[model samples]
Target: MKKYLFYVLSFFTLFVYAQDRQLSLAADVWPPFTDIDGEKSILSDLVQEALGRMKINSTIETMEFAKIFIEINSGRFDGSPALWISDEREKYYFFSKPYFYNQLILVGKKGSDVSAASFDELSGKKIGVINNYAYGDFDKNQEVEVVSDLSNQKNLENLLSDKIDYMLVDALLIQYMLTYQLNDVTEFLAIGKKPLLVKSSHLALGKHVQNAKIILEHFDEKIKEMIADESYNRILELNWIKADVDGDGKMELVLGGNKAGTSAPQNIYGLMHDNSYKEKNPPQRYYVDGKLYETWDNIPNNYKLDLVVDSTPSIEDTYIRLDFLD
Candidate 1:
């Protein structure tokens, strides 16, 4: 009897430890957001502080962006930080609520007549873009000459030397290059605020991680709390970037006064249905956990889940109600 009791207690202890396990995070150096300054990046510091508030400990590792995705998909690491959550990635990983927004812009040398008011205007032009860059709608066109391998500094330099006409790059990357790489070159201009695309950066969890659904739920709650308490805005301000609380291209607090809930999930979905929201890849539902549970039931009893309603109904308008056997 004593031996049996010992075994039972040991099993329970192991289970508890597994439930309390820490998560491993992967990322690359993208300044102001994330930069390698010895042990942590600016974004990592904010994430660490946010996780700490929830009493969750995370171990962060910096590596090449490509390798980070590979490791995440292979289940080698828990997930990558600051990556755009897409439908393709949703198949293998669970994503947290978006904490920030980003845009892809076109940059060219000054005095160039490459007027690209729209994506169609760039047809037949030699476009230099990073290899493996998945630009939702932009990648659909077949006429544009795409010069891959422009992710590296030397490759970008080559492109600048007339190797390619224009490059579709991330705004943050352009900022970094301006501050670090092209400090001497004052002739470049990021013409026309024509946002090629906009996406929210999220923290993702691998499919193989146990209790991924629960973990993601916790993360979502934490993110909401952060946003509501102004921690999210404060972090972006501290990092010297505009705060996008609503995940829209415009950098205004759409959550305050008349703008409150303007871009709420329901309203956003309605805009999508009415063709007002022109996202090439629409939002999708991804089941991170091996099993699916009602969204309401997944949330703790102490917390309230906000549900937004639009003129047109969508999955986003519904509340999740978990049904578990007692």
Candidate 2:
């Protein structure tokens, strides 16, 4: 009996040690997704919190984009929470399942037609894109002039100046602006209903890092667990929720709110908007009072209470509105 107890205690000790493992990670200074010290970084908050729930601690340092991989490969960092897959990068890193996505949606001057089924439809249009960014199949349409440049800020400046007909930017940035910075942003920019491109993002460990594969596999499992318990939505702190809650083999747009609102989300946001999704008016579900309602129509009128917001509220306001300008 004493021998069996000794083995059980030893197993528990090993389990505790594994759970307390720490990881040193790195990411670039990409706003709305990655920020210095994780002040305003959504992905950083989500990844860090997700790791914490998994009983794994992590520290992610923000650096220049070019240096993120270089430092990881040199063993200065163990891994990165933000990673995009490529043949060259796969050589040095073991990637986790796609935990996040970098989705690019087209933007145009207010009142400009920002509708297109594909890049082929936008032939002859001059579009602004960030330099060194990989836009899937966007280059195939040679007729559309891609004005690649230094940054999104430069592109926005050019777009407002009418230097480019349209600009491609990450959808998360659009959501952030709509929530926190949209008061000035919406006056000039009209966003496309569909995304131009979607890049799958992963948590990756350097090949030289110890227990790289095991850590990645465990991280993936914890991500799904986080989503199931609604902690993922809390981490995002935004109204958009994407998950296959209905188990329909397709994802649904869900709104996180105290009350589900009076109707569907006017401007639905996606974590990764599948390029193939061609629905003109996709439906949005709402989470209210800890219950998931399939639609606003099904919601009881008593539960449709809206959070009052001043029409001209402070920019620091963190409240969410179901209505969004297209």
Candidate 3:
């Protein structure tokens, strides 16, 4: 009886430990994705939700960008939800499927006479870029004088002040900042039509972690399920939905509010407009979503709610309603 009791107790303890197991994660402050203080991070939310579905818990720690790679490789943290997979990192990490696509573009002031379809065309010019950012073609270019900064805002400020002839930044970051952080700065900046760099991002688990392969497999399954169920879109809380809102069998780009991941303007359905001024005042206006609402107070209780994913439309072609233009 004594031996049986001991075995039962041991089994119970093992079960409890398995139930309480958690994955420790770390990432850098990539805004519109992860935050510095680890608050309201969209990527964090998606990762946590996916892990939770697998009955696995996680804790994310925000750290310096460069340090995240080194520490995770050294087994300091379990993994990162968002990382660009590379040859060096592949040796020490198990990477999940691409969850995010990052497009790096060049931005210059309006009518500055700096036109280039490729980075090579801008040789001998001074360009500002985020320090530690892995820009494939833009990095290690001896022809261009590369100015390093820690953030996009700093680079934009440098561009505005003529400290740099051009600036490089993630396309999504630029749009998010224009909508939420730097509304006034939008008028003076013009994003290049062509992207300088494009890469897919993934969740990387340190090779040192036990059962990392199985964990990554489960993560991939859960994340894909989230997208199918539309839970992934909710986690992003973006301003636009790519679905066909007009029932015309083609997807029409929709805009939501002043910012993504925030409440839309009260009783307003944001509609996209033509690029009348190019970079200056890319047109956006508020209209009624379901029922025509001229005032916020008159919005109907039965109006349908529309949600958007984190997909940007191509500048060359997009469906827009001219009647909705303000």
Candidate 4:
């Protein structure tokens, strides 16, 4: 048994180190999350910090979104920080378990009924979408007129001017906007409560990369470590998120600041939405300082102070801003 264990450990070690310490990744200009310049980007920070802990030095090359796959297939690049999975992509990409998400929700002018449950109900309405994005089969419905744009900024402009009935938006970008600047402008924008599409964001490496499986395994482990240490929230620059900080098998409203608001946060971000996929309404219990609180009202007053964000977020506070196409 001792000899068998040694061989197994050696095999694992060999498998993990097959690649060099260096990694070359690429992405397009997906703002707040990732960008071409790779500055003050939340997703980039998460990727760098996670890889840094694994002692893997890395560089991200930014190009047109279409070019990312081209470079990866030719072995000119290793992988990307943000990519959505598909059937064909599985053949060439070794994907890490999603570190976060990109939830597309419908947005309309304040007080507009953006609550249509499905595209079938949205027939004949004009919808704004980013060109070349995978919005499932949303663009296929004959009655729906799909308007494509270069960026969300253009879509927002069009929406505000009544050029389009509704626009699909990523929840993370909206959260980032509210967290930083754009809080004032949001009063004019009414976001739908339900998401139109919830897509997972993953770090993907070409299958041809050496030890791609082991590298992703290490990355996934690092993500868990970062979440446990609160470094994930710190790097993400969010006030808090919903997570199971303690190993008690229940979720808690994990705070980054000294205190959180009294009310149960309406949209406390979750690190992974995979749980929501399984249980439509998962039990959300709170754990703090080693105790579990079943109800928000039952919690002590000291732990529930309102978190006030500045009207204008600073560079030191969060990632890059998606300030109106202004």
Best by TM-score: 4
Candidate 1 vs candidate 2: the TM-score winner is 2
Model 3 / residue 241 / CA error / Å? 6.7
Compared to the true structure, candidate 4 yields what TM-score? Answer: 0.83
lDDT of 3: 0.61
lDDT: which candidate is best?
Answer: 4
User: How many clashes in candidate 4?
Assistant: 0
Residue 126 alpha-carbon offset, candidate 4, angstroms: 2.3
TM-score of each: 0.62, 0.78, 0.65, 0.83
Give candidate 1's error at residue 315 in angstroms.
46
Can you write out model 3's per-residue Cα lDDT over 1-326, one digit (the tens) per residue?
Answer: 99789657654553454386788899876665776442456677888888888777788888888888778877778898888777777887899876656666688876764457666788888889877765655645679888988776677778887899998766665555554435344457677754566666777888888767667766777775654445655576544433333334332324333223233433211111111112333213222333223333344433334444434533311211001101
* Ten-residue stretch with the least lDDT total in model 2: 315-324
| Deviation from truth (RMSD, Å), model 2 | 5.9
Q: Tell me the tens digit of each residue's lDDT in model 1 across 1-326.
A: 99789757654554454458777888875544554545224457666666666566777887767788898877779886667776787888887776555555666666665456566778887777655545556656777787877253434464557787776655544444443435333455434344565666677889888766555655666665665455653454321122233444333221211112212222221111122234454332211112212232342332232324223312311111111111
Q: Determine the backbone clash count of candidate 3.
A: 2
What C-alpha lDDT do the candidate models reach, one value each? Answer: 0.53, 0.70, 0.61, 0.75
Worst 10 residues of 4 by lDDT: 317-326
Worst 10 residues of 3 by lDDT: 317-326
- For 245-271, candidate 4 gives per-residue lDDT tens digits of 665666666656456577776666666
Residue pairs with backbone overlap in model 1: 295-320, 296-320, 296-321, 297-322
Ordered from best to worst lDDT, the candidate numbers read: 4, 2, 3, 1
Candidate 3 residue pairs that clash: 240-308, 241-308
